[model samples]
Target: MSAELDLSPEVPEPTLLESLLYNGFFLGAIVQLLCILAVIKPTSNWYEQV
Candidate 1:
């Protein structure tokens, strides 16, 4: 029946802070990787001056 079809499982949405923290953690990880790469590759002009 149509009603039975409509009863498919639904996933809950993340809370605002939970979403922000999840995304923010990846952003921070990317930033840390760039910092480490800059330190390891100082010959590149992009990282050398700063």
Candidate 2:
């Protein structure tokens, strides 16, 4: 029973290119969100300006 339980399939680690692509995607998403916020923020203060 213990041996059976220990027979779970091993997960493969990510390769270097895969790691870089994942990190790049995450950073790109963050930067896109910040750019969107920057664009919306000025418009959001339109009432104050008026």
Candidate 3:
């Protein structure tokens, strides 16, 4: 009888470039939400001309 085990595997760690790309997408989403809110409401409306 013969048995063998494979202890090593070919896998790559995340590089800096890959990490930055991931964060960019996340940050963009938050910024977009803020922009939408700004368009829908105003902080003050004291200049209503009748």
The digit string of per-residue lDDT tens for model 3 on 1-50 reads 27887779968988999999899889999999899988988657767743
Give lDDT: candidate 2, residue 16. 100
For model 1, the superposed segments whose C-alpha errors exceed 4 Å read: 1-9, 44-50
Q: Which candidate, 1 or 3, would have the higher TM-score against the true structure?
A: 1
> Candidate 1 residues 1-50, lDDT tens each?
45555666788999999999999999999999999998988755766677
Per-candidate total of colliding backbone pairs = 0, 0, 0
Enumerate residue pairs that collide in model 3. Answer: none
TM-score of each candidate?
Answer: 0.64, 0.66, 0.59
Q: lDDT for model 3, please.
A: 0.85
- The model with the greatest TM-score is 2
Ranking by TM-score: 2, 1, 3
Ranking by lDDT: 1, 2, 3
